[model samples]
Target chain A: MKNTAIEVLAVKNLKKSFILHNQNSIELPVFDNISFSLKEGECLVLAGPSGTGKSTLLRSIYGNYLTHFGEINIYHNQSWINLVEATPHSILNVRRQTLGYVSQFLRVIPRISTLDLVAEPLLEQGETEVHSINRAKDILQKLAIPETLWDLPPATFSGGEQQRVNIAITFVKEFPILLLDEPTASLDQKNKQAVIDLIINARDKGTAIIGIFHDEYVRNAVGTSIFDIEEAKHAA
Target chain B: MTMSLQNPLLKVENLSHYYGDQIGCENINFDIYNGEVLGVVGESGSGKTTLLKLISGLLCPNAGSVAFDTRIEGLRDIYKMSEPERRLLMRTDWGIVYQNPKDGLRMNVSAGANIGERLMAIGNRNYANIRSDSSDWLEKVEMDLERMDHFPETFSGGMLQRLQIARNLITKPRLVFMDEPTSGLDVSVQARLLDLVRGLVSKLGIACVIVSHDLGVMRLLSHRLMVMKSGKVVEQGLTDQVLDDPQDPYTQLLVSSILPV
Candidate 1:
């Protein structure tokens, strides 16, 4: 049967260029006229050799790259809004429910407990403090974080522990579109499998997933389709 | 395939059950092999729960047979077996993980005692050995061994879920039946617990029949998929094939309805 997938994200005529300072501030073209669409419940993996602006393309789609010249159209609240031209307030609203971005490094709050950090999104969604803390505790337990460390800050935790805390926070709430950047970079093999399972679960929930994965095992396990940045740049 | 050559662990044929005049399920037929994970998916009231209870011998089926091959006895109809024999099978060779933690766990008992109860049921009586093994299982499911003395009521939901899993698997049952194992938690919590279940289920090579309305859980855990509608199976096939290219209209609707992340 033909797939009746709805288009959740569409990018048209996308172009990105960076100013090179060492070479007399040259306007080096990173990519041009890159366009693609992501359907609900579909995973699109960005594949190519390094320096192909794969990560840049993902950030551009997330509206983090402000200087990009293109339309990053995201379907939200019964309409399509261009992230490139969207106001900051609209972008925040869109991100609050529609878009979730997981980068390589976590931006940790200095004094917040790990449980509170993970529960922040649910609190923002108006869940009661008790409910939010209980839910956060559950996620932390699943990630193998001990209960003793939950009330402590994540700043002093190990790399894997911090990454798990970061993952716990990002996935605590379900979003319509998820952007993952090397989500399992610092995880051990066992925990890496945990992350892979989480990604697959997200995709199966009809989340439109666009991610950059360096691990071949993870790429093969969860990816349904691949979007080669080199091909996007060179496609006629 | 080679699976057809070997005897199946459980063969269910034309199983029919009713709740008064209403149909619980009708003419259900399937085979569960050793080391296989079979997922049953449907809307609530589609009789998925009824079918599970029937085959597990908790509810008597109105008609048909459930043939379970036991380690001691050759293939025997589950319904025909004596109560003691069936109870023995359930305690030793089979495990059931309920959707609610309270249903599967002893709330007033300590976490270690809950797991140790299963071990003791199967004839492990050394208190020291039981305590050590319970601690090991606690670590395996990633719960703290320190919580071994705590009551299930004092544990968090996810911890209780993990504790329930450790309790169920402590005896190392050859087959397990899970009903909506992750349904009661948040998205991230469900993902983590599902991950743990997937890893443990595979690492131990246990045959399983899991029932869930959540298609994501089935797709990730089941090797085979059976989609039910209105007390009948609409489709059955390999997990990927049935989920990715559902042939039945009901299956199609179900697959298409999953709201992507």
Candidate 2:
């Protein structure tokens, strides 16, 4: 039943640093020579203490951060693309078809209802509005978001509820690769377990996931292997 | 994503415009594909409207070319076309929705005429058919059937805007340029208009280039975003990537300036 043989993402010799120009051009190195490969049905938990560039690694993989050097090769559209070298259009195409990311905070757009917001990715894939909304409702219900909040914008929701909405948006349509950054950071035990179930379910369905989970309980529940940045950096 | 694989419906390369010494927009380059919504965002005086005008053939660019994939002539520079040819293309294959409905609609005509005029211009001589099509469009835009025969002067700003949309879309244009279509409206009305535009744009499979100062509108409607500053494109990327993780300093400031609700 384990479909873990196919590699979906590979990072090789990746390096990133921030240059503070206004303050005498100080160079802050985040991570260097980071390399890893993720396979289908395998959840790799990024493990590190604070400031260990765990989030940076995830963002690099998602093409949100431009790395100084190296390759982020993602299997997209039946071909492999080095995301570091891919054009903006190709990156966007990968994001739409192959990759999905759930950030720590939701960028709540004004005036769009939570249901529409969650259903948007499906609509972009050309699903009928009714079908997209129905799928959105199913995910929202699974995540325990109240039916009353579906029509309202997520901006007014509580932090946990907003995070759940954010999670629901990404999880509503399964992508080949999923990057989760503190997805359960704001949730309680019950909601945290719900999110854990979702992660395991996606993984079991052959999604390759890289996530940062501060909660050890949730990490153990879903992670197939831990990619510890601090340990890897020291070894390098 | 399949849309990107197709050839771009419109392409702008090194397009620039200058009003005397002031730069309207400089060296702008981008491609808009079928069913894609591309948004240009910047503060006032940042050349968003200028870029929109330059590409839509309202204002010709000084340096570069605006090429469109015309049905008759594939991927021809619009600036090089004969004036009559360009005008015909504008009336038949392209639509421009102005910020003010008054700028786009025939204020002297009824809402039904405003919608039917485009169809008439393209040689739909049957009155019964035109009237039926106009009424259908009014319903699609969620306007009352009774309002179809009323002059636009009697309509409110929202209603007038909706009528202008129906007028532009009646001809079934392949590409549409919308300039702040929901600006200066009530928040509720803006939301409704945004929903309507989003639904129509997808359902009709129109390639749209939208210029707006509001990032929320861009996030809601645009598939890709180009961040302009002082007439130059500082950054361009998928909407979520640009807004959530902005790389350019100007884009960072722009995204951060929004007041969180």
Candidate 3:
């Protein structure tokens, strides 16, 4: 296994902004001439006010936006890949293979069962359905979601159950990077700490997490080192 | 008017709402009073929102009764109130602040238009009066008057929440129900919005029912707190008593889950 403390992702002098109507651009510069690096197994959190471009910066590094003029380096296989030249499709492939994303709102397929939803990443990674289903059931049981609800469409599940399914999806594949957006916003205290413990457990397994959290309880529950997006946006 | 020391504005007698054949809450009983803030805290699916739905007359109780005497009416139970009576109360006596500000707001309409729509729903049609009233509440919620014409998409999430507040409180409803008001806001923004809601509820003497999972928020804002687990109200008491020294095991577990910052 690779050394867990080594740098995994690095960005240098990144700049990105949006345009408005009549040639007047809103120009939301999130990381104006900013440089940062993340080490393997370390989680970086971005906390800020709404519309401060915290989500935008995550999208930019994931190649969802064009970094106006900067370079990003992704470490892999004993070499650093200059992400500046990586195509969006390639970025997506890398993300799919190595990154996991969790949003504030868990997006389970409307009529799909919990087992199927959790098995998606595994199936996408070329695992057989039989193998994925077994893995899914195990995780669901471990998470304490009722076994009877496993085959039922997650639409009928409670808010906490749906979030548990979303959490299970993050663990399906051996991904290195996990991205979560307020994974516990609507959860009561019981589920909030459970989700936090789950994330910390995942980080121990060598996953680099990038989560957007608004709840102080969730933020303090996981990372001791936090990247305040409000300061980041203001400094820019 | 002197209220009886034990008089409750709204009383739930073993009240329960069932989603289809399933029980939302079992043998759930509680009493809410006028001008009081009652906080309901539970997991996402613990039926906190469902309880609010029942009290607002949005949903019918399947197993129990919601008995209340309102300032607006001739009806004893709002569930049995006539359509016109329901309309009247909705128009002037109650407001509901939804969790997703976008879901509660009309994205296409300007902020002013959103507030006007609330008035229009209640049959307020004089455009001049509506505009004046909408702007009045806009300032009541502490929102900028200049941005009244901007669509909800133009406003930030915190601003959108404020807009929803303006829309709901414009008519000065006697009571309001908030479904996770600070679910998706930043810490500072959440604190500000909570303060705004607290101040408004106090100034207007409007009773409030706020549902959230944050114990600290409930402790900071609610006079009383109800703890729900699975599908039951395991404990209910003064917010300080329940949160600071929870008697129920589930309440204690929940309190332990919260990390004080």
Candidate 4:
């Protein structure tokens, strides 16, 4: 049982910085040193004050910044990839096909229908639009998005409605590693709890989740026996 | 019923709105005192948006009246006010930022155009004045003035929302409406944005009506909350009261649903 349960994604001594024009010759270290690992069917919540670079770490993991220094080891399909050595194209491939990412914002394709929005993840992996559309509808129904909302651009939906669409896309992909950024922030209490329940449910189904969450209740809900990122610092 | 004794900047009485025989919301009555954040929380299609529209003068009420501290064009109630009067009154005291940053903004337009568009509609056409004014507001919203010439595409989601906020608050309108302002942001970004919004709202003493579904978001930013269900407000009170120990079944279900566990 122990041998079968392996990490889905692991980072070693991840470091990132930026140059500020006002501060000469000195780089502004957003994340001084950060490292964590997420196992299959498990989740780790990153909690911190604003501007502490919590979002930056997620972006770095997703290769949103190209200049970051880090060694991220992702285990996919029985093969371990040293993400530090992986090429940009390969990393993009991983992101596109294997990584389920929930960006901070609901980044929908403008003017696209809601059904198409949820189906984009499936399409990213070359799934046929007809099959993807059918699957997207099922996921949307489970997520509690109304059927009438399927054809309208998400711009017309309430803030909560738009958030549900963002979430529906996350589960449409058959990925092991899920990266979510405040997935429940727009939802009301009922929907937020439902989402948390879904994540725990998804975890049990073998999806490793790395989420930057501010909800203290969600952190405690996930329980202990975790790889706490706050304790790790620059030791690769 | 013994009414709330305290004087209110904005007052609602038996307020109701409908969409083609469908009750958008009904029997809504509340008094919003000056300098407080009144939050409205509910599920999708619970009529919170319609309530905001009615209260903000964006849509006229079908059944009741909204009385403002300062009347427009000698009209006593918003429902009875004329379009030109609403425009003149809104210019002086109403500001709104939508949930979708794109809706709150003009996406293809430059940052300057986005901020100045509203100002121009209200008849501020001096170019230098618009630039200087919008630039200072951008700084207030924690945006870099150097990127002031860029379009919304070049900006991140958080920055775009911030720009929308700057444009709304630049006028220092007395009443501000925010519909899920932090809905599409990361926690870190949400924290910063909420802080900026709360700080600015408090500093200017602007009375605000924020419609959000996030209990945490509402609790963090609002003084009071009005929990809605179906098409009516189930409960309205201080945030601590409504969220901690709700008596109404719908409100109770809502409070319980936020377990985060």
Candidate 5:
């Protein structure tokens, strides 16, 4: 058992519900009164069937989706900030250095080259052009991106290529906490292996990881603890 | 863990070099067999990088010889070969993976061209065949084949590193020199890249000389270990033995300093 004293993230009484206007104005409760704690170097895998709001729970912690009620507290530096009540500026600051999210899509400015897109975070962090570009190039190479398309917009890239580029940008920084949503869905065997290795490395470095992995192999390889949303629903 | 000892693919004997009066490395000796991985680890200012440069032909050693076993020439001193001969050897029989992909890749050309250039250098001319081979290598390094035409200037760091690996390994080089191949990325990215490297090295059965300050990397990939301090070897043995039970105090500190996960 992990000590809650050193917990990086703690959720208490987390609840979410939405009005189903199309279905007689009924209110659909996703999950209620859920509490858990995640420590450093621990991964909590949200395992359940589709439509279980697995992604919703992850986004709520990231402050993208607002919950009906509950406390999503994330420990930053020393004190804990309640995501459900924190201001936008605090959320932004926490996201910059402490939290990272790798969704299933690659969102970038149109016409921007792949290199600039991936180098944006480092460049924003005040890294020099030479150093940032060099670092960006290093990550791209590890993800198996060919050089010729680096200057072109990723809009024209295949699904797997774009996903790899997305992963590259998110992983380029070393955030203390990460949320992964099917990070390797479009990857092949070799690429999947690469992603798995990256996840393991991050965990070993004491990053708290929370993710939803539909691939059983990947889930087994990366998950240290399971957070079954379906079971949570039943328990509630 | 053990590689074929039959014909030591590369032999470095009494190798010594200097940058002005300062020592680079002195009297370094080792033999890398076919499909062997030799790890060199030390703190900053150690001669590990310099020794790698010397062995990979980037820097000429002031003394001793680097002999390689070639199919046609048998065991011949690499320094004695003509410039063209040495260049050919580099293209066909040897590969070097730089710590920074920027140092090893051509940023102007398309990723496919970067990989295909090596094949063209070695007399391959069919455009279709070259393109096909480049695509295959891209896949091998986990890159999408569709981006073969993209220039390296726009690639992310991890993507560029993978492309560089694919570019260097496409020619099926028998021996590879890697300089901190997994440094400067987040731990997760580094781990993935290291796994890719380990898989490729073993699949291709290529001998390698890897240099890194991270003892974890050395333990994960190296078959034999060489510890250096003050430009001299202090302890050398199997990777596990040297890491688990160090004879030198420097090595002991290094092993103990690994942050617990």
Candidate 6:
């Protein structure tokens, strides 16, 4: 286990629901009163069956979804910001600096080469183009993405290949907090092991991580603690 | 990260425009930092163009102010400035590329003259320097130096657009407003143009507000996106986040409507 003295992320009394406005304003409650906190060098794996709102919980913490009530406080740049109340500009700033998210799919601008896509985050951090491209090449090679495909866009890449590209983009830079959704779902055993190693390395570097992994082996390999949403709901 | 720490280059607050009772755009607000790109996307008549015009000072807004950090004055409402001051700012510090290349270019002027006009406006009188800078920009936009004296009317749609880009960027403007820059071009041409625009924007560290209905363009160039519906901003966020997991219903529809090739 690593040191848990410095808190990186905290969620308190979080609640969210989907309103079907077109369908007579029907309400679909996803989760309620869910709360968790993560410390530096900790990986909290969200454990639950399908439809238990594991992904929803992660999206809420990332500020992609608006919660009905609660606070998602993040410690960034030696300050605390409630993501629930932060402006979009501040959220983007926080995302650029402290938060790194790897969703299930790779979303990018069309016609952008894979190499440039992966190197973008570093460029945003003020790295020179040459250095950023070199670092991207190293990470892409480590993820087993063939050199031939690095020049092409990920739009035509296979499902597993695209997932690896998504993973590579996030891992190219070290972020203080990471939220990953099914990163290794489409990856093979070799690629899965590589991702696991990357996660462990990030954790050892004092990065707090929250991930939802369906694979039992992956969960066991990286998780410092498991937060079961179903159990939390029952207890609530 | 360094971008957010700096003061905003342009700040727009509660901007709204009305054509009599009809709305152009309502209650718009955004701040653009140096080297940042903000994309506005919406279907036809979503006021994307109107919003651009409002901020560029081409059209006056009924409400709100457009604050710019000028070189002389710190930050002032552009709409309130004297007409000459505003025109000088437009000529010196800003560039606007219209949807139709013809709208922004001079029909009778040679390509070199078009690019050199802005430099001359800012008081560059040496003929050799002007000629060399114009040729350099033409090459930067990937046009042949041989075509420096060719008229824009003789050029193809893609070439015309590239010339427009070269002309706008010659002044090294701090902010650029692009309205549907890649539309009406072949796919390959569009791709090349997008790549060129992306390269130049980052290389020059020029802030841009680009209005396009093409999600691919938004995904390619913008750091942040604001989705418009009718005349209101329905949603806005980081480009990848907004597109990957769109929260608004309209944005979801718009995103799903794209037919995969």
| Candidate 2: pairs in clash | none
Tens digits of per-residue lDDT for model 6, A1-236: 46445998999988888765445656788888888899999999999999999998888788776664989999989999999888767787888789988999887766889999999889868899899999999999989999999999999999999999999999999999999999999999999999999999999889999999999999999999999999888877
TM-score of each: 0.54, 0.91, 0.51, 0.51, 0.53, 0.92
lDDT of 2: 0.90
Model 2, C-alpha of B38: deviation from truth (Å): 1.7
lDDT of 5: 0.84
Tens digits of lDDT, candidate 4, B68-182: 7774333257667678977766766788888888887888989988887777878898999999998989889888888889998899989988998888877778778899888
* Candidate 1: CAPRI quality band: incorrect
Query: Which candidate do you rate higher for DockQ, 1 or 6?
Result: 6
Task: Flag regions of model 1 displaced more than 4 Å.
Answer: A1-236, B1-5
On a 0 to 1 DockQ scale, where is model 3?
0.01
In candidate 4, which residue pairs get closer than 3 Å at backbone N, Cα or C atoms, i.e. clash? none
Give the winner by DockQ: 3 or 6. Answer: 6
List model 5 lDDT by residue over B64-160, tens digit each: 9999998797888888888888889999999998989999999999999999989999999999999999999999988888889999988888888
List candidate 4 stretches off by more than 4 Å: A1-236, B1-7, B71-75
Off by over 4 Å in 3: A1-236, B1-6, B72-75
How well does candidate 2 match the true structure in TM-score terms?
A: 0.91
| Model 5 misplaced regions, further than 4 Å | A1-236
Candidate 2 stretches greater than 4 Å from native = A1-4, A19-27, A108-113, A128-134, A148-155, B244-249, B252-261
4 versus 6: better lDDT goes to: 6
Candidate 4 residues A89-109, lDDT tens each? 346456655677787567543
Model 5 deviation from the true structure expressed as Cα RMSD, one decimal place: 20.4
lDDT of each: 0.83, 0.90, 0.75, 0.75, 0.84, 0.90
Better of 5 and 6 by TM-score: 6
lDDT of 1 at A126: 66
